[model samples]
Target: MGETYGLLSLLPIAVVVITAIITKKVIEPLILGTVVGAILLYGFSFFPNWVGDLLATMSDPDVVWTMVIPALFGILIAMFGQSNAGTAFRELAIKYVKNKQNSLLATYIFGIIIFMDEYMNALLIGGTMRNLTDKFKVPREVLAYVTNSTGTPVSVLLPFSSWAVFLMGLYGSSELLDGDGFTTYLSTIPFMVYPMITLIIVLLFIFRKVPMTKYVKEAVARAEKGNLFPEGSGPDTEGFEDELEENSGNTKKPRLINFVLPIIVLVAGTIMFDMDLIIGVILAIVTCFILYRLNGTMTYSELFDTSVKGIQDMVELIVLIIAIFLLVRVNENLGTIEYVITSVEPLITPLLLPGITLLVVAFLGFTTGNYWGTMGIVLPIILPLTQMSDVNTSLVLGAMVSGGVFGSHVCFFGDAVTLTSASTQVSNMSQIRVSFPYALAGLILSFFIFLGLGLIV
Candidate 1:
């Protein structure tokens, strides 16, 4: 910021992007970047400076809100697991799914419907649909594709999701934004081009309107011969199968009410609470407690244990959130965004902002395999730039969202891809190879759409 670094202001970000890509990890790179930025800012005294700044970041109200909300959603999800509601919902839906085509379609639809969280969506859809898809001779790659495609994209696009709440909290908490986060998020919905296009592409592929890649075609052909994967070539389960079995096993048959009622409370309560996601999730948890208790699905001790386990389940996410906040603070000190804007401002017009934002964020998201982390770094930068340039706020925000989802959709090492691969027992690389072309197609279309809209709107 003080011309101490000039172009070197970008060093930390470069370290983060490059390290993340090379190592296929997010937290370590983010931490390393933060350390690098801190050193750049405070020289030999970086340790205390870093700790102070990180503590400040951790204590920020919005950061606390972000941390709390995800844990709450985890609790709600755990409750859903205890109720076997996802299984119930799956059982109910699979009743009508009689073939490969319908099985894929049903997986896609369920992926969208289970929009509360991406992890839940990936695991639920992949785990529940795997046997059915296998029965119908659908390749694991295909199942992985449908599951991964719908995971982050749909979760981010919809308002009721953990992704949405986290994003909205980020937007509203930014001092650059004057509008309410929920309203701003709703405004971005229509312009979120990538997810909509990706969903359409999935639908087209499901209906056989889109041609499969040769690899996918080969996989499909193999599946038709009753081989879901090449012998010994599937991903190492790494205990995922056992984890899934442990989590999903229920002696009692899954009741539809156990699945449907809590979700209804969540959505309806959120709306009733004026879009307060935390309260909404709390209400849903309470509803789950009562419903499960009345139905004897869980005793008080079991319920409490599940609640604690749920919070435990979210520790990794919470740690990532903390690291993201730390990196953001370090970047602020390094003036990373400030340097970027100064260098790019003369070259970038408002008409180019949306498309450029999409491309840049998409590249970052894909390389980092951390969509939320990427957004945490860029949103602070982009929001300020948008205000200065007078670009359409929602348009640019939409592009940002679209780009993040695009990256998550195709990145082989991304959480969604990893989880889906593990859940469906396909190699992570195999799913990415199968899904990349379609994701790329959507990316191209989204970039053009953003460009045109930037010109017109």
Candidate 2:
């Protein structure tokens, strides 16, 4: 971060944000940004042969490993989906939950279970439950809410998650804290106000049978009128007949064991083996094939083709993740991240940490507009702060995650929001209109909880 052409260092970050805005796609923007960053690195003499170095580094095993695992997970999901396995799963889940509320709850339950990573949780749950919720008139925003609420906090709390590993490395390097990874991460979980409150909010909505928000309410009404898109998508009169045709003929008779047995296998396999999620996901995909084969859903080659196609659909997401990673990395190099952390660190008292952290996280989340990117930047700062306060690290980490999810929840511009809007076939504004108020409510509640914990700790 030497000052000569320091401004140039920020070009890549800017490139990404601007590209994301203009193209509304991630892969190309990131790759372009990487090239720009390489040029800057060369011009600034940041490294010897920096341009070549950066290009080589782009394909580094660490970088590629990050790409492969998430992409692999996406591939597995795509496979299951394309093979009509997900459609079959949906048909079966419909039989069990019959009630929409229960169906939503089941989503919450699995969202909590897939705590190994946030991105994994977002894509996996969204892919699996998309059709089921669609069948029951649930908005994709609600599903996004469920995924966002559960993903981050659960990972922060769970020792085995990639979040834990990164936090350990970041915090461990800071010289601000001295401790083992387990103690450090565990100490921060309770203070993660957003996810905790989010879970509570979800339960309240389900248990109280809360009516959907106004936009969501309208979304539902439109859905029932046989239109999932906004009324402008050809309106429903002539369109409804065609939509009915799209949904009608392929509805498979529900298979109890086809769904039940595989889920049991998946849950059991992950827990019993204490598996890495890549392995865990691979196991799940394998289970899909086995169940499909057993239940006579598709022949072997068709399963392979569907899985490949499913994985292809998520290429956009994989590119987004990779690009977001580079954007955060550039932020780190540009000193913007450090400037914010240093300027804000002293502002945090035991009492004020919760509110301030949440506020700051929201701002970062909004600017970066990425949950994982937000967490990657913030965790390094807060992990050390927890030691400074001599507080419970888990609670502090919880607050960190809470703040991130809080921002991402309302960020209609984020990848998750985009995907939710896509799957629901709803307008972006519709997702925003519905998610914002809900996000605000959850944010306020989570802030108070963090304040309470900060006071107590």
lDDT of all predictions, in order shown?
0.84, 0.59
**How do all models score by TM-score?**
0.95, 0.69
Locate the minimum summed-lDDT window of 10 residues in model 1: 230-239
lDDT by residue (tens digit), candidate 2, 174-254? 334567434565566656667666677777776655556777777667767765455442223221234223433434444
lDDT at 46, model 1: 92
Q: Cα lDDT of model 2 overall?
A: 0.59
Residue 433 local lDDT, model 2: 71
Which stretches of candidate 2 lie above 4 Å from their native place? 1-65, 87-191, 207-267, 271-274, 324-350, 381-392
